[model samples]
Target: MLHTDAPGNTRQNGRWSSIVLIVKMLLTVAWRNLLRNRRRSVIVFISIVVGITAVMFNDGLSIGMISQMLENSIGSHVSHIQIHAKGFNDNRVIQNNMATPSEVENVLRDTPGIAHWSPRVVSFGLLSSALNSSGGVIVGVDPEREQDVTTIRRSIVEGSYLTGAPREVVIARRLADKLQVGLGDKVVGMASALSGDVGSDLFRVTGIFETVSSEFDKAYMFTSIDNARSMLELEDRVLEYAVIVRDINEVEDIAASLRSKLGDEYEVLTYIDLLPILVSQVDMYQSMMYVVYLIIALAMIFGIINTMLMSVFERIQEFGVLMAIGMRVRRIFLMVLLEAGMLGVLGTAVGLLLGSGLLLLFSHIGIDFSIFSEGLTSFGVGAVIYPRLTPDTILNVLIIIPLTTVLGAVYPAVRAMRLQPVAAIRYV
Candidate 1:
């Protein structure tokens, strides 16, 4: 071999080494330039910090609201999944009930992820007290099983939960108020029986429960499955089955499994399906955040541009001297860009630290917005909100802040590059 390629490799390595040295020099010069204008740099740095912190805190509040809504809705009544007769979700009539309930019960029992399941006789009816009458949905449940799947027992504000006693009913606080009834008050429930006639029964109000939702409170009444069966003239059939799973994150998989096992006769629905509006709200929130990020980025871009432009104007003569001594125009441009990059990197790092700290603190202590309690309750959310720092929000900030700073530096960097060395050096 001639070994001629050895010189070529050596020259390539030398060129790469030269590039690295030039980069190191440019970084040092950029850093020194930033230090020369500490006040302006600090001002821009503080703006970024404040902006990032505000955005993070706002996003955290939204996440907390959506999380609370989901928890309250699921804990109150929806459960993790619901199994209904094929037409029951749409029609919800006495005729549209599960005929062979034993098979569904068996599947629920054998399913590994199912924690608890409760059967319900759901029917629309008129509930009347001695004082007044109101229309609501009647839910017949097994007292003990319902306790495991729903928070109705814990939500009892007054009186007692169902004890398998005959004709005992649990009414919501709003319904109670509407009917001018309280615990122990006698109420009449009327519904359409399977015999093509109206069926009616007398019940004693045993408990009054108040959840976060006023609508849910006013719209539903709970009674023993036996009493409901007796009044409705039904056999051992059920209209719906509410199921709770061991883990909520696995609900979609569990629902799919249940659907496969149960076949087409039954409808397997998850909380996501039951509460579509809430799911939409969560998605809408994420979409709306992009608009918020745009606003913040725009503000940051302008701030960086004003600061960097001022720095460039002040250093016009200095740039002229460097270029006069044979510094390339591209090197001047790269130096300006490096200065902006430094600002972005430093500001973003500090901002993330402070923002993340605040999120962690609020996640533990929570923020009280009880002043808006009435409004929050209407949406099935709690008064206290715990801020969470999600990975997506952090990733967006890490990308946006630095990109905004660099984009802002473009005009100033170009202006520095266009300087005529002789004319700039002679300027006052």
Candidate 2:
């Protein structure tokens, strides 16, 4: 019994060793076949390279552009989160001012993640210089604290930021242009008061600021919170609290905690909530990119199919000879599949390296769209965009390209495996 078992085990080992050798030889042949038609293989290789490179470049650009827009919006005035009276964001009415300022202020001060907070008075009103008049949103802010929360102070291009002095106003450069006013010019602001009566005040254009957004430039005017309260007849009350967090990524968690503390009367909103359109642009770009990936993959699939079919057809006689010499039929199928996969992997590797290099280079140097600054400014994106590489984008490239090529080779592989040895050998 021991002797019989030993012989059977030996035979099994020999059979496995032969199978390994055959597979190794088939792999070598598959690779050689690709080299045999170098022109076709190189052409297919270039196509895959171009497709992958294009995908990476597009993804990087879109991510960079949207990210800059979000940062610009937040830094301009949105901040990380905002605490507003229940109806204030939607209605912008003085009647919707925070009902209990002390309570809300206490909650914010106690909040662990809040880095800085500033009270604001917001209203829609008209600013008229003697030469012209433009309607815009008026925001009242604490000069010192607002500087801690927003970048408007730094964005003052032509004049100084607000000093919290009596009746001081800061207008956008574009708005200043529209009103035919400049620094030290006088302007009158008019708005509806909490008492349902029209409120008006005269202000000096102490500063002019130019932010990334042309729309924001033309649509907002800022002044001291004291002056704004006096103008709108909402003394010692505020409509919103603009907040900045120590870590922006933790904004949602902090906002949730604030909501629970402050209750339902006040709305605790993150930048994601306050700037939905800008935030949604990231998701929209990602969704649209999948369509782009599919188009590129489909193009590669057809290219791979055409190339593999040609390789299979040109080697039909050689395949017949292999089968006649006792090579298994399935080896032919695997060989073709292997060839296609090798082509894909080689192309994808070169493409990924090239694409990642481009992304890395541009990430530091940045791409300047300054020539089209007007169009980008309208969308609230800056002129210079620094490309970013995400793990998910890299993962997509690793998974899609090789799989597409392998799937495309199925038909050619099947045809090669189905060849009849005798008939194939007898062919001319």
Candidate 3:
């Protein structure tokens, strides 16, 4: 038993040692082959670098736009989540208002992830200045509490936010311009009161705000909660509760918790639900990225195949000599694959470094698309976008490079393996 075990162990060790030697030889040959044709190798490397850089830059831009859209939406008014009375979003009537705002506030205060919240009274109404009138959504909010949930206070470009004074209001700059109104100017608001009567009131424009979305700027206005209650005759009632979470990632979970706690009377919605157009835009961009990747992969595959095929043809005599000198057909195939693999490794490494460096540099300075500012602002995205590189993007690139290399080598490797030593050696 001892003798038999010794022989088996020796055979296994020899097999492993043979594998190690073959790998070392293949690597050495591969490295030499790549260096032999410097111009061809450089061309292939440049193609890979360009392809990778384009993909990374484009991906960063897309991500940046999406990030900015989300930030602007959250800062403008959407917050992370909103709790509204059932069917309130569909029909913005006084009847659909939240009756127990105090109870909702208590629940929000008790919630673990709730960072800040503000109760709002939302109403669609006709707003008019002395010279012009336009239809707009009137938002009533607590001066101090609203600051934590929205950036309305910070977005005030002129004058100041609602100071809790009776009849004080804030208008977006676009709306203010359309109405020909400015600071301390009076704007009349007309909306349906709880009694089904047309409630009208005069409010002094205390502030003018400018947000990313021009449409939002023109369609929304704000006033103190008390004044809104008086104008809409909604005593102590609110339309919704805007909530900001401590962590944006935890928004869905917190919304679920709030839904379960609040029961069926209230409907909790995340920004994704509230802003379906934005969600769709993000999804569309993500889908487009896959198509872009496919195109890039095809370009890379063709480039590699062309380079490897050329290398195989040029080294035909060498492969014939190696095979004639007792190297196996499988080894020849492996050598061809190794050469292609090495090229891919070197190119991809350099490309990744270059792309990552560019992304890092641009992330700080940001890309200014001020030329398309009007179009971007219409979609709630800012002109200056800060590029972002996610872990997923890096992972995708890593996985694609090796797979592309292997795919590109298969035909060339197979061609090398099928070569008859005598025929290959005799060929001109």
Candidate 4:
């Protein structure tokens, strides 16, 4: 009220002398009002809590999703780098003219950045059971060297992985079901070339693997390179050579380096290039998260604005009394702003604490998608997605909540400043 002495009041003489007490007094009144109407305060509390909860849920799922994508990127699909026949992509066929595998292996071995290397031949064929059949792609890999290339070893659910020669095969459970084949069963696999010569081979189903991915589970078979070459009649030739670097995340750089060195003689692919589906998904998820965050921030802003506006209306009589003595409208504005600021700061503190506790609890127990097992699988997500809370969420919530509250309250605080002393007195 800018140092105004009201009646016998002598606590004020100048703006700075009275500013501290006026702020303190406004806060005391606002807090008391907040407590006086517990129901409305509870509604505000719930609005903020729900808003934070939505943020936590979306953020946690996105984290888990990205983590799974990274794991899958490293585990099964593309190793850090891939070397393929130059025209292998355009024709989408493996050629017999492969570089001496030993020469390539030696180079990869001596390469400082390369940590793990594996040779593989990819082929496509229709797998047939007695009553059913399905077309799927197959990979011929060295079982002993496969572990270093893929976590397929860990995903083996039944029977040992096929090793040695070309008679055994490992298949995902989905393909096994389509062909009505199981461990130890003989499944006839047929492969054809761009030329007319074709061959059908019998493979004993040696192992069954189960991963949460329906796409993988549905259509891939694993065998030794010898089997793949024997069926295709291409000896001493490989379709592609896959490699893992010291750091999987550096795949794009590694691929670029390989491409720069090798030129067009070979095609180098990275995990990023291998699974473009995840790249698109990651982008979409990030965009959606930002949208949800903005909506929640706006909701919090409105709650604070409504409360501050009501406080300004209720205090009109008191403000008028101060103004009648000598208080300036600008001073009244600052006092209201200070009160709104206090509420914003306090509310943010409480909201953050509540949200942190809830996030911690969810992180420990984990938000299970098991209840939506069928739904998640239909969408290609695993049934168990652990909730992860990063420092980013906490920082965003803390910053956004208070900042939005103060921004929203500014309008009401401005309106209070425009009120004249006589008009405000008659406003009640």
lDDT of 2 by residue, 1-428 (tens): 77876855674547889889877887899889999999999999999999999999998888888888888888888999999989777877889998578999999899898999999999998889999999988899999999999888999988899999988889988999999999999999999998999999999998999998888898888999999999888989999999999998899899999999999899888999999887788799989889988999999999999999999888888889999988888888989999999998998899999999999899899999999999999998878888888787788999999999999999999998998988777766
User: What is the Cα-based lDDT of residue 20 in candidate 3?
Assistant: 99
lDDT of 3 by residue, 1-428 (tens): 67876755674547889899899989999889989998998898788878888898888889888988988998899989999999887776888988888878889999999999999988898999999999998999999999988989999999998889999999999999999999999999999998899988999998999988887898889999888999888999999899999999998999999999898998899999999988898899989987888899898889889999999999898889998998999988888888878877877788788888888888999888899999988888878888888776777777787678768888999999999999988866
Clashing pairs in 3: none
Clashing residue pairs in candidate 1 (N, C-alpha, C atoms within 3 angstroms) = none
**Which stretches of candidate 2 lie above 4 Å from their native place?**
1-25
Clashing pairs in 4: none
User: CA lDDT of each candidate?
Assistant: 0.90, 0.90, 0.88, 0.74
User: Can you tell me which runs of candidate 4 are displaced by over 4 Å?
Assistant: 1-39, 110-115, 193-196, 246-248, 321-350, 353-365
Lowest lDDT block of 10, candidate 1? 4-13
lDDT of 1 by residue, 308-381 (tens): 89999998999999999999999999999889988988888888888889998999999998899888888988
- TM-score each candidate: 0.91, 0.91, 0.94, 0.83
How many clashing residue pairs appear in each of the predictions shown?
0, 0, 0, 0
Query: Number of the top candidate by TM-score?
Result: 3
Task: Looking at model 4, report the run of 10 residues with the lowest lDDT sum.
Answer: 89-98
What's the lDDT for residue 74 in model 4? 59
In candidate 1 the C-alpha lDDT for residue 413 amounts to: 92
